[model samples]
Target chain A: MTGAALRLDDVACVRGGRMLFRGVSLSLTSGGGAMLTGANGAGKSSLLRLCAGLLPAFSGSVVRSGGVALCDEKLALDNEAPLHRALSFWAAIDRADAAQVDAAMDAMALTPLAEVPVRMLSTGQRKRAMLARIIASGAAIWLLDEPGNGLDTVSLDLLGQAVGRHLSAGGIVVAASHQPLPIVAPVTIHLPDHQADAA
Target chain B: MRLLWLLIRRDLRLAWASGGMWLPVAFLLLVASLFPFAVGPDAALLARTGGGMLWIAALLASLLPVDRLVAPDVQAGVLDQLAARGIGEEWIVLARLLAHWIGFGPPLMLATVPAATLLKLDAAAMARLELGLLIGTPALAALGLLVATLTAGLRSSGALAGLLALPLAVPLLIFGAGTMSDGSGAAFKFLAAASLLLVAITPFAGGAALRAGRD
Candidate 1:
């Protein structure tokens, strides 16, 4: 399966007595990319989370492809779990290939750390491990929040290549970041800067 | 049907991998043994108290594993994902309760035999002990599941879980222990009646609590 198109209608989100995003609407097609850009506190992460259904939008609706893989900056790993177990915990439900796990691990430069527990890894390494895990999730739509947070020059380029490959494979990708994103053909929707109710 | 099996197996696998299955059974045994030590070795006292003691230990042991039924997996975002997979939330709750039964309920029933011995119960009492445990442990798992789902978000949930479960569990305990005592045959009938009601309504209550957690 490649990817399904995603659509949102007037997706408004409010938090902490503040309106994060209001009357936000966007549609992303297969092989399509939308860059979510905003200064801090402008709801980039919040918007991405809403798209992933990890957080509820205060108003409006979000419809996305099933099996949406969310790769967040925090790298939600259970501390007591081994890298293999934590990575494979949910994937244990899906009958996927060992080859896909290997491909994801190699793509993210996480093969060597596969034996380490999540608590043993450094922040950057944990992030990379999470990227590999979600890649193995085989999700059609990749909602990434700060995928470029702590990556060095090389990993940033690696991430750009990953996004490119994902898009070229007819997958949908939405990335929320503050810094200049490393992708091409991305429909740049500035969160606060480009708050038009239509996209 | 395949997904249903997959879910049941997945829950079974996770329960096994967590080293969670045996802990409560062991706890029940240890708690049962302590009663003999604390009260001295009067065999008649042990015989008379055995059934009630076994029921009490089963109740406590059964509750120990309730948090494992959903909270950790929920915090990990696994349960929400399962719900999103077009698996009805009710089935998820049922699957989880079944898994809890496998992990917490059956072993509890098995432990009652040893508990009967520890409390110096005779053969007739042992049979009734088995009956009480067989019916009551499921009720325990059901009510525990309900409380566990309700208290998922609280920090001091262990206390809250006991608070929520023990009151509801009282009837099961009374009927359960009654089934084993030298009390009249009528007591055993009442135990069966209570067990039937517990089995019937627990699923509905547990499902409702699980739905609340999803929202």
Candidate 2:
């Protein structure tokens, strides 16, 4: 994943007939991380989606040089499958071998819940599962939207450690969070309150 | 192609495990049995009208599983996850179309064996019914997928899917039932044409709908 990068040039986002933000630009190279900060409804999630090409940019362009993984509010796993199988489905799609899945589960401390169905897992556990999915994907760029929402202090520390390891290993991370996380991201993008300005 | 196969396998497993695989077949069989009670057992009348009635039954039965076809996955963000992995929406819909047909189409044809006996259909009529279903069920599955994609995000989408699909399925019904009475093979050709057209456009239409819905 060396030389992996994500760049957004003069980006603009509009949702539901209103402009959420415009003229935002960023450039991140390998082993770098950026934190996105704003109050509620500030389009932080939407920006991450734009970077993933899930949402069309209302203006400008986004370019990336590697496979991307997004860990958002949706778990995107089958509720009926055991946690390991659910994670393995993505692991297979990502072409990540069994060792990667095992390593991801260990990283998230989810080995004990491997046999549990996804629906039975608590919120924090499900969040960890989503993170584990990103880890196992082996993608170079990670777009994490509100990744720490339901995590307790210990889980939060684990999240930070996992992200730190990813950065040290030459992966790129762009995360949106309201609460401060322990990871060191030199760049921060604080979305302006366009809604208030419009009013 | 491996990606498409993985999707089809996952969808088939989901459809089968969720018990949706049997709904349309059971509905078709139930309709076949109920027809005799409703129409009275005039063997001649049953033989004359049974094939068309079965066509109607198959068409209606195709609608039974529409609600689950695309909505659950869209809501679960499964489709988005696939898209993020660089899988095309057309490929996703195509895989789903194949899985949907496998889930309902053949089972419905097999169930038609018992249904044919219940309807007192003679051998000729039975063969015609089976052939029509073989050509027509693919179109029904495609239409269902198209409608499912179109209505996936709507409130009470099942009813809307029914409304949208029934109109599009009229050509299939007309030509499929026509085969039983039209001694000529013309009706079968027309049915095949309609089926191909639906099958050809389904992936594109369903794909565009999914992309638009994300907006």
Candidate 3:
């Protein structure tokens, strides 16, 4: 995770022929965290996506100095495979060894459900599985969109601890959530109204 | 190289788990099984036209898996995750192309044995048909992938994929069917050329399509 960084320079996003946000900028280095807060449809998720380079910024630039792992609304795991095997698919793709997958599952307390199919997991369990995937990815920068949406209080604590550990290990985290999370982030970007005119 | 192999392996596993591999073969078999009944049991007529019929069946069979090729992964964020791993879109498309070919091409060729028997084809024509499929199916796989990437996000993408691919696949069909009748090796040469061109362009074209449609 050396030299890990996620930087955005005056980023703007336009989706479906409408501008969602503009003039947003943030720079995160190793051991740094940022929380994106905004009302629904205020481009919080879009900003996270921009940082991950999954969506192109309408203007400005996003640059990353390390591998990025994004955990959004989609579980993105194979539905038919067992939970451990589904996570292993991404683990293999990320070039992370099998032990990493096991460790990630352990972090999220998902070891018991290892043999369950992903589709059968409860909503909260599925969210944990998604986080496990990010952990196993071994990526330096994590982009989490609404990671707390379906999580319980205990799971929320797990998520916060995971983020804390990742930052302490020289990784960067950029998360967007409407609800308050337990993780402490030094920087917070609260997106303004979409219709507000800001050049 | 490991990345490519892993991607191919994952694609093959997913295709198998989803039952996508047998669909085209089943469709090919179904078409072949029904062909004799439609035209009546005239062996000479069956032999002469069956080769061409097999060509048509293969072409249509190729379209069966097109909807699943790029769309599911895109929806699942598989491609984006791969992209974030510094895996280029071209490499993803290339791996998918190879996996798709393996899923359909060889099995379809094998299925053609029973299919050819059902169609009343003689030995020589069966050999020509098999050879033609070997060369032409790669192009079909390429075309399906190309169209799948192009139509991934659109509504009714399955129908749109078929519409987009059928036109582009006409050349492979021509060259493939041509091999059945011509005694000379010219049709095989042309078929090989068409396959090479499609296989070569698929990675670039399909990769661009995926990138452009990422939003």
Candidate 4:
């Protein structure tokens, strides 16, 4: 965390003849924080995808350093794997010793379903498993899409703290959230819909 | 390498524990069983078509659940996490396809024996047929995974999966079953070539899949 910077300059994207975002530019250095807010189908997720490098910007340039953990809309988990194995997805992610996995399960309230296959788990638990991965990733940039979805207040608070810790450590956090998060450090990039007529 | 291995291991573990592995195998067997019941349990007809029947059933069974493969991940916001991992979408796709094959292939092969017995395949024929299965089923799995990826998001993916995948897999099934009946070595060679081609192309296909799944 906190050792890198991300600079996006005049990033414009067009998809299916629709302008996703135009002249979008921003910069975040170590210990920086930002969030994106927009109406339904306003391309918040699209912007996040661009930042994650999953989608190439149609025009303009974006640069970033170090590993970035983007909580994408689709999970990479296969239908076959169990919960623990799915959690250990990145072989490089430092997992708790056996005790730690158990402790994480307790902390996340994931203990009862530790043996359950991920495909069988509910959406909420699945998100928790994914959060566990984010913790293990130790990445400096957290590019999240709806990180608060499927989470109760307790889990949401935990996510906020985890994200707060990342920011405190000089990491950068960028999220496209539906509801305002409970973190004080988050800054909002309010994209105005110029396309809208006076209605 | 670590990321790839963890992905493979996780997928395998899920397959083992969730019984997700068994559904296709059971479906394959069920399809095989349908042959005898429909065809009046004649041993020769049953034995003669066992290889072909098994191959098609395996292919169809392999395709059944794929309609769901990328849908949930897309809905649940896990795919974005995958992209952020910064592993190439290509490798992630490859790792996932490999896991899909492991879960869908062996069980389909194992079901062949039961299929063979149920379909009244003779002793010698069943033994020879298993060899073709062992070699050929992987070809089915590889191609099937690619198809599954291609149609992972379609409105009628259940139907589209076969519509797209069957053409590519037909040759494999043709030669695979042909060899069982005719003892032609060329069929084995063809299957091996297809398997190798699938292995080679899966990474790129997976990359394409990742891009497509993002939508």
Candidate 5:
């Protein structure tokens, strides 16, 4: 993960024939973190999607090296499966071993709920599960979309610690949230400043 | 290959858990039983037309699972997670095609035994029906999955999927049924060709639909 890098060169995003943002550029290498702050419909999630290579940039080049894991509103786990099995499914896909899955569960304080069915989890617990998935992914780049949503202060602190560990181990973290997160992100991109037009 | 297998396994488990794998088989048997009542229980008439009726039933049965094939996973963000892991959409779609066939094709074949008995299909007609289904179900599964992906995020996707897949499946229905009467074996060849083409193109087309829908 040491060589991981994410670079955007004057990126622009257009959705539904409306320009969301433009002239946004940022560069982050291993151990770097950036925060994206904006109101709803300001393209924060789209920017994260673009970074994960799930969506193409409307214009300008968005480049990345190393694997990416995205944590968004969607849990992406099997609803009926036990929490452990659901998390293990993704760990298997990411090619991460069982030990990493265990550690991720531990990090998010999800070990106790491992045997619980995913559908039974509350909103905050589900958010923790999503973060655990990202942690277990072993990807060099993490694109988190409003990761703090539905999280208690303790869980939020746990998320912060996890992101800290990731950066210290030479990984990149790019998170989008309107509310301030616990992680230290030296660069913040206020999307409204990059909006294509005021109108 | 391992990733494909993993995906297929997950899909199979999900289908089994949801009890969706049985729907098509049940529908096939139901159709088989209903045909006798609809046409009156004339054994000779059944022996003559039962194979064709079974073919139509199989076609309709294949559509029963279409709604579950792709929409739930797309809505659940499983596809996006797979994409983020650098897995190609083509590979994902291909894995799904295989899983859909595995869940659909074999069970439907197994159900055909009782269905054949219900329709009073003779052993010769039974053999043709089974063979046609064996070769043709892959295409049916592919068509259903392709339509599932296309209509995954839309409103009333279940009803819309049926409309979208029925017209596309006409050729399959023709060739599948033709296998019973056409002693020339040409219908089998055509059915195999259509199966091959649909199975080959579905991954690419479905992958594209998924990607386009993401936008």
Candidate 6:
């Protein structure tokens, strides 16, 4: 976790022949966090994907050191499995032990719901489950897209504490959300400022 | 290697949970049972044509589970999560191919026994049919999976998958059915070669398709 870093240099993104954003650049070392603030279709999600190496930048480059974990809108857990088991699958894939899965569930206050099927969870619980997956991943870089969408007050607090602990451990976090998040992202990139002109 | 096994186990569990593992076997049996009704109870004719009919049934049975193979995982974000974990798309597709073959191939072979009995096939013909299926079903599974990956995100992908897979499967069908009558070992070799080719290329082709489908 010590050497974690994420850097994007003057990146431009085009989708379906339309430029979404351009001239975007940001760099974060270990213990650093960046908040991407933009409206819908502004490419906040695309930018996060670009940073994760899941999407290519239309121009420029994204460079990262250390592993990455992304928590997006879609819950990747198996719907039929119990919450803990669903999370454990990913933990195993991430090569983390059962202890981390248990710890992540506890961190999100999801211990009580561990035995419940994933599909049975409400929206807020599902959101927390996604967070627990990120926590259990133990990746040095966390890319969270709208991590607070359906969370209530207590759950949101749990998210804040998780981000705090991750940053304190010298991990990098890049969260994209239109709504205000509880963590302190010292570098804020309001994407509209980088929007490309329409031809 | 452990990760590959883990993925195959997960896919098998999902296939079992969704009842997809049984669809191909059931379809095979249903087609076998229906053939006699369509052709009447002419025992000689049944024995002569049963092997070919069963081959056709197996080919169509392979298609039944194609719709459930790749699309659900892609929509559920499973592929993206695995990709983010540094697992290659080819590994994922290879694991899925193995799971798919396990889910349908052996069961379909077993189901062929009862299906053959229903079709009034003799012992010798039944042996050939089973051998043909054992060698050919992996190719069928691979074909289905490859087509599933290609058509995963398209609207009405199930119908599109059939149209895409059936034509490519012509060689397997020909060689598989050919084995039943060609007393020589030539047909068996052809069937094995075709199966090997499909099984070998499915991982790379399906992996590329999955990666390309990602946005």
TM-score of each: 0.85, 0.98, 0.97, 0.82, 0.99, 0.99
> In model 3, which residue pairs have backbone atoms overlapping below 3 Å?
none
- In angstroms, the error of model 6 at A149 is 0.5
lDDT of 2 by residue, B14-77 (tens): 9988999899999999999999999999999999899999999999999989999999998888
lDDT rank order: 5, 6, 2, 3, 1, 4
Q: What tens digits encode model 6's per-residue C-alpha lDDT throughout A81-180? A: 9999999999989999999999999999999999999999999999999999999999999999999999998999999999999999999999999899
What TM-score, to 2 decimals, does candidate 1 have? 0.85
| Cα RMSD, model 1 | 3.5
Worst 10 residues of 2 chain A by lDDT: A190-199
Per residue, candidate 1 scores C-alpha lDDT tens digits across A35-105 of 88888978887888788776677889998865677776545555666777667655655555677777887
For residue A169, what is the lDDT in candidate 1?
A: 81
Count of residue pairs whose backbone atoms collide, per candidate: 0, 0, 0, 16, 0, 0
Q: On lDDT, who's better, 1 or 3?
A: 3
Q: Which docking class does model 6 fall in?
A: high
The per-residue C-alpha lDDT of model 6 at residue A162 equals: 98
Question: Which candidate comes out best when scored by DockQ?
Answer: 5
Q: Per the 3 Å backbone cut-off, how many clashing residue pairs does candidate 6 have? A: 0
Ranked by DockQ, top first: 5, 6, 2, 3, 4, 1
Q: Flag the better candidate by lDDT, 1 or 5.
A: 5
**Which of candidates 4 and 6 is the stronger one according to TM-score?**
6
User: What is the TM-score of candidate 2?
Assistant: 0.98
State how far residue A101 of model 5 sits from its true place (Å).
Answer: 0.2
Ranked by TM-score, the better of candidates 1 and 2 is 2
The digit string of per-residue lDDT tens for model 2 on A1-199 reads 8899999998989899888988788999999999999998899999998999899999899999999999989899999989999999898889999999999999999999999999999999999999999999999999999999899999889999999999999999999998898879999998883343543
In terms of lDDT, model 1 sits at: 0.75
Q: Alpha-carbon error at A119 in model 3, in Å?
A: 1.0
